[model samples]
Target: MKTSISLNQENLSLIPSDVITPSYDRDKVTTSIVHIGVGNFHRSHEAFYTNELMERYGILDCGICGVGLLDYDRRIYNILKDQDGLYTLITKELDGSLTARVIGSIVEYIFAPENPIAVIEKMANPAIKIISLTITEGGYNLNEATGEFDFSNPVIVEDMKNPMSPKTVFGYLSQALKLRMQRGIPGCTIQSCDNIQGNGDVAKKALTEYIEKTEPELLPWIEENVSFPNSMVDRITPVTVAADIERLKTEFQVEDQWPVVCEPFKQWVIEDQFITGRPEWEKVGAQFVENVIPFENMKLRLLNAGHTVLGMLGALHGYKTIDEAAHDKDFQFFLKAFMNEEVTPTLGNLGNIDLNKYKKSLIDRFQNIYIKDLISRICLESSAKIPIFLLPTIKAQLQGKANITRATFIIAAWCKYNDGVDENGKSYAIEDALSNELIRAAALSHENPIRFLQIRSIFGDLIDNKTFVDAFLSSLKMIREKKIKECVAEINSRLS
Candidate 1:
């Protein structure tokens, strides 16, 4: 019977030697990067890379000061703060092995709701050269249809009204950038680690728009000094559950409050256009490219769109996890076909990447037995995800006259999924920012099959395209009449 060692700075020596602990003195590591939206993905991806860079190269200036902007983030803030901003990163390998490492890159965390000024001031610090973000797709506050920053959002509205005490990411950023400008501190690079395509451009647009409205005086300074570098960040970090915490204690004798669990696969491709100096993360498995668009498209169209395919189809078929869906022969066939036929065609130049190898790796990654990425997690906020991840491929396919069978079927499947009941009659809540609208439209799909597509904000003019509308209706009809697995098999057969 072994007692668990609490994972903290003081207990580093007491933790099992098998677990790789940070060798660098964390106290000496200054927070040079102020990261907003400290979530599982940030910890597993960005912090993990920074930790490796520090551990191997002895570069300690890139330590992260994580700021939580949302009320829900208080949980992670409390957990990481209690654990001294130290957490275990457990990578579930393809061979069913787990590699556990303690990440110390996050030396400090500020829950913005508790003290917004602290977060703003921390960002204003001249030493903090790069302000990175992992605020998810929805966090940018972009209107999915207009492709612009939504100013009408209540938080953005309130943020404009009261700039000093900010609510949204844009508000905090505006306030901080203003402080930096007033103090004559050279502007830092605002790097976006979110999944949106052209993430950096989106960040700059959102922030500039917010600032132009709130503090028009700061535009010239921002134009002269600020930089927003686009980046493509890939790592499948599943939401941590209690069992993950218990497993850390039981197997490794390390008790961690929130351990990040992800697949062994990780990749980051960044544009080397930072105004302020950045970490030499290139030495630590991150790719620095002149243009991150090719990488971004390849990842987003294939990996992300692939996840949505499995997630929607799997949910409709009553599968709970990605591994469960990927393990199924039909689901695997459907996903592979969708990737090869629908998505690969839309991808731009990937340079040296082998499409066959990449697609195969994606299938293998999705089937990782240990990751168990929840379909629900993948399915969350499909309203936002579909527009960014899937629809582009659809539009491109529509334009190119390429394979739209599986893509159309996916949209149909998404409609059927929004019915809020699986084929097995199990009721599951449809998780989306526009859940109510989706459900309402989906309910009308029975009478008018195109009702789901009528959400012009999402589907856009695809409803008017005869090829798209006809295929969509055909798929929806088949979905209503046949089992989801049968529908997937049919599409797989047709595509093959």
Candidate 2:
């Protein structure tokens, strides 16, 4: 038998008292856009924002049809379906306050490979105005060094060959656009909400490059029609666990499948570009900016960069959670000082945003004990994350701004942390794709740290400079000689 949690107008209140009652019409909710990777962050940030907009502004033109490409996601897909696509988002504020709201923006869900043609047809619909993504950093077909599309990947090739809206996110997007073009329907806007810098450009590059290699004729069609809007979306949504569901039901009196619990802080800065049409998300606290570069760069460079510092260090010191990491006085001090003294000074205005206020909020969120975002989650894929998150500050410091000694120390700690052994003297599991290569490269550090730095794929041209190189060497040496605590102190001493 079905899970008995099946929700509909006929069985609206029949939903378990534990289930949330969304004050909206379920029948009129249409699948206007198909989101490719419907993960926790997307559910909390984008879903919550859109639900608020629909309720307040009546912009029902964009009900989301969430999709997952991975087989593991099918279980999650079914759970949401059982709940009538409704879930609760618990926003934990810094002031010991929690707000739980029912999210009903996602109308339906489909696991793509299992229902390939169905996904294609749903996306090919003329009414679908946008195709947004939260497929994470590794999902993109990126050339790590060039930060552009790698056209030669097998998935891209398969997408080029089989072509039922390619199975990968890029393929799905390209194929969906192809169908739209053939049907004479306006193509959907592609918005990426991943942490990768220039996320929209990355999406465009992947889709266009695949089309250029596979079907050259389709390239121009994409350029002239579809829009890939770059965006900066921020919210610290921890990877959900079994207890999160129970907490939502017990505390907020709502049952949620894969419920998203996040810090109160949320941000989505988009480069206002909608091909067919778009939601009035601005009414619901989404900022529409002209350029997303400044916002993206600052957040990645300052907040995320700082998080990596505390994250790796925290994990190395056996601290499991971000709140615990933040409570480390030296770590917290270095983080704040790094942001205020080093990173923030280099950044320009980001959509009239108050940079100081933003930093304060980031710091406050990190202190929320209830959220419990793990350092391990933040520590993954350090190689891809580092160049964008930490390298910019390395470059910025070289430009004669404030002292980036702390930021440079972060870069060094990451190097040693990645290579450094635990008390058992064994290598820590490097979770990144280039883990083996990075470990192998760091081995050459015994010969020369400079040579290790020469890997342009990781650091790019930033490694070439002598000034930053010297700082990196000094910090690395200190980290090796003293402990993590001492290294933090030494960097602080130097910057002071």
Candidate 3:
């Protein structure tokens, strides 16, 4: 049986930008969500739902005004403009399910840094009820150890000195809040859509601190007016590929170059907090919880953390995609083993996670052939990711009798990956915030495991519990000598 959805004029072309045109009828769709860093994940997770909202309910004013950080984003800004804020989202299923949907939620995209005042004007618009971000972990400009804004960063320093020519998200946020305060527009809710614990709270704290440190004048108004709703967003969207185009054409009867694909499983757990209220997102299968802590912590620590571990090890082990890595039963076994043995104990409060159900879903998502997320994308910001995602488990393991061996191998593999060269002696670009420093440190760590783990920011204070450090160091040393695959096998043996 042939399965293809006929495309409307917008989605009928090969180039994604060919179909991008501003929806004339979007006057009904006001900017309710102001999103920072208009990346693929944001498009897949949050904006995808917003599109669902409008489609299901005929609700208007559920549009997103995308805010890019720099003038360099002019390229994307222009492309999205051509589409008139419309694009295609191609969702793939593990059990061979698929959907080709055209999303028209991003009403406009602006390179905010190019015109700071205009960006502020857009943000300060009373119609904008929520400010959501997918700036990623590293994009938060936080110090790895401190979990606070790193004003010491030159970009932040520049932002502090000249808020208008801002280089940091904090500066733009505070400046926008100031503008909002001046106009008496209620400051919008700040939503964090990244894979982080206390995402909204983190954004709130970071932005508040930025204001306190740099623009004390805006702090009072911000404290009273803003809402920061914690949330958990999950999906596995890889960068677009050429095959996706042919697939789009064959499946959706549309030609889109940048169609996004992901495993059909999608979940959004958001706190029911919004200024001027929110879309009845629950109408579109979003879970509005009283507290998003358990969900956020669970997903961030287990799922995202696992994705990273698998991604790095998979690459080092010469696998290109997550599914390929997952197909290696040995690799998949290590993943499940670590999650169960080491990570679970640390997360006692994960109520009703339904581990078996989750595992089945996880395996399916990872093994979905089409949702080909690259290992390197997941490898960024190990400095930020490891502390939240893995360290707590490591700490708990140290406090208990769980084998630290598997955990040790992961750390070792990370150190090895950070050493920054592929098996062919070709250098893989390590595009992390602290890439150079990490490469330098990882290189030295191979020589002195103890000294390497001592890096306070990357490993944090928890690792100093000598017991964990010793175990971790031993594992790292062994892995460096034995290689990841062999070390993983050894670690699994210890666990078994």
Evaluation by TM-score, superior candidate among 1 and 2: 1
Candidate 1 achieves a global lDDT of: 0.90
What lDDT tens digits, residue by residue, belong to model 1 across residues 1-496?
9999988899998989989999999999988999998888998899999999999999998999999999999898999988999999998889978889999999989999999999999999999999999887888887878878898899888988888898899889888989999998999999999888899998999889888888999999999899999999999999898988888888899999889999888999999998888999998999999998888888988899889989998899899999999999998888887787788878866778898998899999999988989999999999988887888888999899887888888889999999999999999988888999999999999998889989998888888899999999999999999999987777777767
Candidate 2, position 65, lDDT: 92
Q: For residues 133-226, could you state the per-residue lDDT of candidate 2 as single tens digits?
A: 8888878877877766776778767776788646787667667777888878877798898888899988887778767776687788888888
Give candidate 1's error at residue 284 in angstroms.
0.5
Q: Give the range where candidate 3 is weakest over 10 consecutive residues by summed lDDT.
A: 15-24
Instruction: Return the TM-score for each candidate structure.
Output: 0.98, 0.93, 0.90
Those runs of model 1 whose alpha carbons end farther than 4 Å from true positions after fitting are: none
The Cα local distance difference test for each model comes to 0.90, 0.78, 0.76
Model 3 alpha-carbon miss at residue 81, Å? 0.8
Query: Mind sharing the TM-score for model 1?
Result: 0.98
Question: Which is better, 1 or 3, measured by TM-score?
Answer: 1
Per-candidate clashes come to 0, 2, 8
Question: Top TM-score: which candidate number?
Answer: 1
* Least accurate 10 contiguous residues by lDDT in model 2: 1-10
